[model samples]
Target chain A: MTRTVLEVRDVQKSFGAVTAAKDISVAVPEGAVFSLIGSNGAGKTTFVNMVTGYIKPDSGSIRFADRDIAGMAPRQITRMGIHRSFQIAQLCNDLTVEENMLLAGAIHGASGPSFLRRAHDPEARDRAVATLERFNIAEHRDRLVPELSGGVKKLLDIAMAMAGDTQIMLLDEPTSGVASDEKFPIMDLVMEALRSTGVTVIFVEHDMDIVTRYSERVLAFYDGRIIADDAPDEVLLDPEVQRYVTGTPA
Target chain B: MRSKLFLGATAAFAVLAAGSVILPDWAMFLCAMALAKGLVCLGIVGMMRGGVVSFGQGLYYCIGAYTATLVANSFGVSDIFLLTLLSALACLLVGMAFGPLLSSYRGIFFAMLSLALSMVLYGSLSKMSVIGGTDGLNIAAPTFLGWAPEGRPLQTALYIYVVAIVVIAGTLMRIYFDSEQGLITLATRDNELRVEYLGASVRNIMTYNYVFGAVLGGIGGTIAALALGHVDPEFAFWTTSGEFVFVAILAGYLSVPAVFVAAIILELVRSFSNLYFPNTWQLALGIFLLVVIVLLPNGLGSLVGRRKGNAA
Candidate 1:
């Protein structure tokens, strides 16, 4: 078994008694494609927020690399080689694509000579080009983010996360709102990028095919708790996950 | 295109600075004051670019002016360089302490809260008669290296104006917005949750922004105090803060040079309004601002960028 990279124990979160997450516990091993599958309000986003230090759980401990990162702020956590992309592609709309990638690299504390061109430099133009090429949007590097289509924006958002030199990436519905045709390609590119970069991926996705295709391990969330954590086929076959997700086994 | 814009700004600054040498006393004075106000507006520009509006900048502005005025008047220390440095440090502390509180609020609430804070300082100053309260205190011409001005009022004002432009031009705060910290600042503006998830302390970034902004306001205030030769409680009024906001909107959230451009335009409006339409200049100014806002929704800075982009 791969060594565990993330551990969550008995985590609970509530907003004035409207419990968002309850007793959610899961472990993600290093270098694995971990998918957290859930319906709306299954507390999947909330759980992601908790692990990335966006939200502090009311009662629980989250350990990443054996350090309890229960209440740390997101930026501090980002400096530690973890990064996340928003569902809405939270990019600097006025900036060029290369600038966005450079900013990501800078945020992850990567800076040196030829910071914008060296292959290893996060801010290197080559790295941004590689990301844009991987996402099939290399032609739009000089363009502003606001001018891109929704699918392109989503792709660029993930590319920016890749540029950040992240060791662990938390992607929230990376394929959501994307065109049906572009979905698989984008997911393939993202999964391939993660595989090439050797970054541990924990993505929250709703589509079973995309999740099953990209994810090696699946953690099913139902009613704000993890109901099944196992291999993709096992989690898909689990009776509890089927009942909670689709009202029947797949 | 960006390089061209920077070049154009440098040229404009050169023209403005050179004009002071030949312009009339009233014209030079107006220009000098415009540059000073432009510097203050630059701080507002930075905050606004990051999607936070501060309506209380006058708090730091007033604090800066008072720090310099108090030391100069009470201790008879009139050194321009020392006074400016000391006052900026004082404003930096005030900004650091007060900035953290407003980092959590956004939109009108943040604006209003900042406005109220400045008003508090203004109110307190009015009650404290020792600081001359409502009347304010008069300051002598700043001594440069202990060399007293030889009754060269115009020359002295020109010197102050040059300093203001140089400081404003050299300011690299906007460049920081492009840095990692700057992206985080912008991220906080776009999506706080996403910024947090990226492992950045939104609050700390905000705090950092506030401290730098306060330093900008303090620098501007110090220059204005030197130019005006007085420091008053009115400097802390909400209207003063509002004026800075208006200037920032006029400049768009871009380079420091843009702020000066807007400030110069405003100064000309005030001057020409008083000159040709003295009776209704304020109303004319108000109408002009409305038109600018309506025409250039993004700001005058956007126009500048567009023109330069097209040219390039």
Candidate 2:
């Protein structure tokens, strides 16, 4: 079972006059931290969105867990053990951290008599507590998401993606807008929390330091195309990659 | 804790039932009608909690009343329970038919679309000949399980019946607000996009909520029709739906019991203003709404507490 978890080949997408992804290909291993680095409008997010079924690639194939899911709905993709975390931490701000955890888990956990069933059924509650504890934010269990600090919010966002049987995750800028001092710790906590799940994570990030530190491999984007794909150190020093990375303060 | 809630609800309902027995005829009538209004407003609050402020709830309310009236007139069936069920069924069917279209909209679009649909119903009711047109249709005296009581006994039985329905419904609604489906409804208000990522169909969930709201609203309307012994085009009017929404906002969309409390307070406020100010009663309602909106942005429930995530 050395098969790739996700495969994207010759994917191309354009919005009227603007091309978001052009002649790109990627194959993520079963369980590895793969990072994408690019500047604003460099198509990193567009690529992630396409993989997660938010945007249909103009021409290409996207296979996940042995199934071609190129044109599926976001919900359908998520139900197939794939989840996406937003750049700004798309959480139910009106709900408590515990409530959010339970709500995320409720999708595939129970099905019948939703009105009569307890949302945080004993099993779901235990799993929620376990997830919160794993992310090291159990202290904020009863706290509203709006009351959370940026680091915790980011971690919670990723943790929510892990609440289900998420075999693959597409995290878009998990550390964006986070406090500089807390960024590494948040990423470290996320890595630690999700380590046991053996989840394959594909993250789009702008921070070179974070990309080099946590990711096993890196994909650098330039002009809506992948210019470099190798080990973090090799891709970091590549002349073409350096020009894109050093030229813009992404 | 669950037992405590169960017991507390039971105790509160017992007190209300007892109070209705000891109170005079006018007070009992007021309480019965207020409970019905509360039920309708509760449905609005249900949608309100999901960030969907519907102004077309009057459609279901009117359907509920008219369904009961039609069945009574057409088939001479006056069983209150059966009439309530028929009204709920009618609203459920209509809600299912229209829910898919309306669920895709949010904010002002959702609100205006709902208002427009209810207005369509209102216009139809005003022009229909078989449904008594603008003059409205008359409902025969309702019976309970083949026993049609007259005068005091009738009022007493109906009061008990209303109390039972409200109490049971309130309890179920409480359970619903805590359930996963209910929590997602609240979550839909927070971020529908995230709800979709969680692998739940946002529109479908909202549609179910809308249909549930319509069902309860229909039940409320049927109760009102039976209590008043009349069904009219005015029940489907925008103003009537506005009153339900106003009460929902005033109540803060906080809890099930709070809905009943808000409706009773609203009815009392209207009754007192009409007695004291006569022609300016509507003006008083407007002023009260303004004051409530300004003072309690979260509605009257916030006065107690605004605990985070208590989007009940």
Candidate 3:
């Protein structure tokens, strides 16, 4: 059996009148490509946000490796080997792709301030180049992120997160803005590259085909609760899971 | 790239040295004043890179000027370079103390807080009689090493000294802005959240630049005090800080060189407008600034940058 890298136990979060998550418990094994699928406001994003330390959950615990990461800041969690990418890429618009990648590589290695270290030093530059090459974004090294296409920016966003030494990554809508035909290819590239690194990935996805094709384990959320959790084929074919997927009555 | 920058700096130094020898007294004096103010504006450019616009830089300027002036008054230490360096170092320590506190604020809040602090300094300076009070204090005629030149020789020597200091400081700042730490300031402005998640504390970086800028302002004030032969509470006034902010805006945050260009242009305009319309000189400046901002939101450096991009 694969060693568990992240375990969520009864994690619950709410916003006044809205419940974002409820009694969500799951165990993601190391090196597994885990995908979350649900309808609008099904608490998938909220779950990802909590696990990645963007929001403090109302109850329950988010343990990464062995330590509880319930109340940590995003930066603290990132330092502890948990990182996330936004639904829309959160990138420094004016910085070159290579600069952005080097920053990630530097952050991945050094826990302290990097005031004097050159961003294009041999190690960082080589790592950034290698990550870019993996994401098929090496040619856009000098191009500013704001100028890149949405598809390329999405890919670059993932590349930046991967540039770091992360054990688990929470990707919020990784393929949200990409064209339908391009979604599978993007996920395929991300999963394949990360597989070699032995990193666990928990991604929120909307496409059923891509979800089934890539994810070893699939989870479906219904009204802030995990209603389905199993192998992709089994979970996707579950009767209650189908109802949530199609937004139909029981 | 290093060789090219080195060559450019050498050529710049040669031109400035030559200008100091050949230029008329009035023009040389004007250039010296502009170069001093240019140092202060360069510091503002550094902060601007980190998404901050301070309106209290006059506080540091006041600290440097007053420190240098009081030292000269009480100790009779007249070596200009030594006193100036000592004053700048003191101001840097003061800046580092305030950096973390100031880094907590940004946008208009940061601007206003800085303005309020400088006003406090101005009020205290005006009330204190020990430092000359409302009459202000006069810094003695400073000597370089052991030589004290008077008349035209003094003017020429002072101009050459000021130019050398400005050139060396500006070159060092250029090297800094090109470094990894410097490039990260721009990124911090662009996205503070992303910067934090990337494992660099935004506050730490901002604090670093803030203290660095404060030191530049201090050096500017020291040079100005030495050249003008006076130090006053008026140096701590809001209007003084406003002029530095104005120059920063005009220069754009694109590069270190832009700050000097903008400083020179500002001095020229102020001199000309004051000569022709002394009462409405500020009005003239306001109108000119409006036009520039309307036409080039990124400041004049972007224009130069675009031209270079096209040439390349």
Candidate 4:
């Protein structure tokens, strides 16, 4: 009885004469690991920006949990339990890792029912520490973000998005630019963490290995449009998707 | 750690109050001026930390002075409390009218626009015959509630300093640095896109920051008017805005209380330079600023808390 958690219907966006996303539609069911894989300039991030309310679409409707979130502000979207991480891993470079989690926890935990008093409540601190430990970076929690390695910073970024009891999470290129050896383990941790939380997850990724490994469904975007949406194997085998990923058909 | 921090503030307050009592008239004057200026600089601190540098505070400062002066002169009203309240209301109205416009600009453009707007006010005041024009209007030393400031200068200075420290440093500054929305302001400064992804509107945050900074500037302007006992278009000049910005950078924007310390030091230096090196006072101040900027990129407060992190 898992419900369709997020639905984007006929969304379209453009910049000047360039169309970024055209008549795009997507539906992510509850607790599913849905992934969109495209090369650079394939409009994946643009679609994400629209869904997160960072950019207004030229036309379309968006809904989450039967609620129209078409043009809602990002803060309102976040308050509705949808949180996102960035492709660049926007760590608070000045603050410690623990402090970053504390801020995220404060944002999520302090919402609704005694929101102001909950700000000074002691439980928020305990929750921050526990979330840090979940990412296996708890030992370095006290260290500044700039001091952490790229992989560790990414881990902390994902950990922050997970701090609140969010039902849906959108991560842009979760493992981009990570050292080759660190990639699988970090993705393993991310997938394992999301699985345990039962959070519906959608992410933009480039690597086919990671996509097939983590996602139940693969969404293929080529020229600002969803060309194929199916099981990873089916999408991988599709002629158009294969042509888009690797030049020329075999 | 929090308790220790509170204790340290208490100790600093006591020492400053005691010094005010023991110092000569000139020293007391410098301290009172510093406190008033420090209170105004809090608005700059709030604005800068939110990643916006303002050069329009002269507008609020002038608003406060003119409101108080007009009331005391024309209405023949002499109640200090009543004057402050009226001036504060005037500042709030100005802020409300200007907030949306100020919120529309950012970076150097915003700074220049604010400076231009304040200069317009300065120009108007300088030419207007209603308030003594360029010569400026004189104001009598206000009686607080009922007690006159003539014989009780120390008591009056201490009382105003206490108010400045408590209201400016304690409440408004606290909201700027420590609130949840405060953290969001930092987030907006660091990465607007990231904050948007987290579900916060960057535009709304900037507007709120503008309004808050304006409110603080208004309060500080009102306090300065009462302390100086004068109203002049000169206070709204671009140079006054520049001085506020310079002190903000010199003190570093890390802690709110640091603005007070920076203001006090600057006023003391100004006074001493006027006394000993009257011919090249401005040159001495310029060189001092250059040295401070070169040596401490984070400002004076960074020297105090260098152990924690780099300049905030």
- Each prediction's whole-model lDDT (CA): 0.76, 0.87, 0.84, 0.76
Per-residue C-alpha lDDT of model 1 across residues A20-86, encoded as one tens digit per residue: 8989887778898898897788888998888777789999898886688888877667767677777
Q: Which candidate tops lDDT?
A: 2
The Cα RMSD in angstroms, rounded to one decimal, for candidate 4 relative to the true structure is 2.9
Q: After superposition, which runs of candidate 3 have C-alpha atoms over 4 Å from their true positions?
A: A109-127, A246-250, B306-312
lDDT of 3 by residue, A68-185 (tens): 9997888888888887888999898777888788767766765443555555667767888888999998988888887788878988888888766789988889889898788878
Please tell me which predicted candidate would have the highest TM-score against the true structure: 2
Error in Å for residue A166 of model 3: 1.9
Candidate 2 chain B: worst 10 consecutive residues by lDDT?
Answer: B303-312
* Clash pairs (backbone) in predicted model 3: none
Q: Can you list the residue pairs that collide in candidate 4?
A: A74-B199, A74-B200, A75-B199, A75-B200
Instruction: Give residue B311's error in model 1 in angstroms.
Output: 14
Error of 3 at B249 (Å): 1.4
Predictions: Cα RMSD each: 3.7, 2.3, 2.7, 2.9
In model 4 chain B, the worst 10-residue window by lDDT is: B303-312
Candidate with the larger TM-score of 1 and 3: 3
Model 4 iRMS: 4.4
Which candidate model has the greater lDDT, 1 or 3? 3
User: What order do you get sorting by DockQ, best first?
Assistant: 2, 3, 4, 1
Question: Could you tell me the TM-score of candidate 4?
Answer: 0.91
lDDT score for candidate 1 against the true structure: 0.76
In the order shown, the chain A TM-scores of the predictions are: 0.90, 0.94, 0.94, 0.93
